[model samples]
Target: MAFGDIVQGSLQDFVNIDRFDTELCVFIHIPKTAGSSLSTELDRMRPPYHNIHRKYFYGDTVTFSRIEDEIAAVIDSGALADARSCSGHFSWTLAAPIRAARPDARAFTFLRDPVKRVISDYRYSRTPTHPTYKETIERFPTIESYIEAPETQDKMARFLMPGDVRTPHEIDTFISTNYAFVGLLEMYPLSFNILSLLLGHDRMPSEHKRKTENTVDNAVDETPRLRAMIAECNQRDTVLYDIVRHKLLTVRDDWRAMREQSRPAA
Candidate 1:
């Protein structure tokens, strides 16, 4: 719990004050993995522009036309505590552009079980206000038809590669290379602790440490076709999930033991 004198300033002064430094931390915010909550906490901890504007950028945009503009705006608006550190739900392709713009930036990301994530995404995609979900679903006779359709593939491709047109190999490469730290959502406290260490904080804010919402309960009755569609839709995520799970398992034995020790000595 000893956070050295790395940061020299009052916490209040740190918040909402823009100051750019040579070394920066880029939080790669993947959707639905407690991203919004974490971003809020980071915003409170850092300055306003320090948290990247996820809403402003169109997720479909392939070119980096607006990234430079946003960065410049952050610099001009004095909303960034450190111009080097930018956090948002951005594509991995932004790595080169970010580095070119700010060479000293380090990146981090959080991931979760792909099946659960996709189910949550589906639920969120459907809203009383937004008719896109209804329209998209209506276009297909069934979820299976939607999954097998070319449009689904196109959408998935675009989503997976937000800033660039990437092949499967390229996508994997981008993720592995760009991210400095990849925390698994299943290991909640450990993930937060790791992120805190990376951010040079003693502990994560208590407010940020809550259970996730929008989760799909296993009790929900899903048809075989629907299940198949869901699985197919999230196949790539499944691969990524397995990779992350394996990596975490490699280093989690000690953490597991510590957790067990902390439990009531029954």
Candidate 2:
């Protein structure tokens, strides 16, 4: 039900930091994840929220370099203490300035199954609902093409990895070592409970701020070839997803009990 109960290792193996101890909690928002909904729940807790400007999302790549720079500047300007938490689509390195400014600040993020995430992202991109839908549609008309593009390769890794990290184990070590918690989209209930426990929440809100995937009407075919291509392109993301699943869901007796309860009768 909590971090100690669910996570594979002992709480002592990780940091003792939590909402009570930290000046700021950082939420590294990856696109197509459930961050918006989680952020809304964070809002209900009545803490000051800092959102990195979405304007960069609408701008070109020449500008992606500037968002964290601007945010890092804000941290340097001594603006971070006023906010309870900050959430954005910035890389893991964004935490560097925040941690320097507020040493106790903790960060967390959610990861999704790579193939499903891409399928959702592709469909999301073709619609006006996505911020850069027009450009996405103009550039990559097919799901295959979209998944094959360099930008789409390891979409999750783009936000998670900092330098030329080669393998998924490196990412696993990074998140496990740095992040306060890592939530899996497939196991949101357990993930949410762990988050609530660590954040010292008395009451938990389950409502999602928005369902972006519901906006897209057409579903991708998800043929065998397409799935394999998606796996190949997102090797790091895929392995990380599997690692989290095995770590959280396979080793624990509680998780096995939950699986048994949800299992179909023979």
What's the TM-score of every candidate structure? Answer: 0.62, 0.80
Residue 244 deviation, candidate 1, in Å? 1.0
Candidates in order have lDDT scores of 0.52, 0.69
- Model 2, 1-266: lDDT tens per residue? 21223354444232234444345777888878777788877665537777775453344541334676778767776667787877887878755777778776777778888888888778877776666667777788778778888888787777876767657667667666666777888777766655665666534447854655544433578899989999988888887777677766643455445446656799
Each candidate's number of clashing pairs is 3, 0
Give the TM-score (vs. native) of candidate 1. 0.62
lDDT, model 1, position 162: 53
- TM-score for predicted model 2 compared with the true structure: 0.80
Maximum-TM-score candidate? 2
Q: In model 2, where is the ten-residue run with the lowest total lDDT?
A: 12-21
Q: Pick the candidate with the highest lDDT.
A: 2
> Total clashes, candidate 1?
3
How well is each residue in 1-266 modelled by candidate 1, as lDDT tens digits?
Answer: 11111122332222113122235667777656767666666555544337555233234531234554665566566544345356765555654566565666666677776555654444544433223545544565443454566544323223334545355566555555555556677876766654564565535446653333332221234666666666677666666656556655654654455446556766
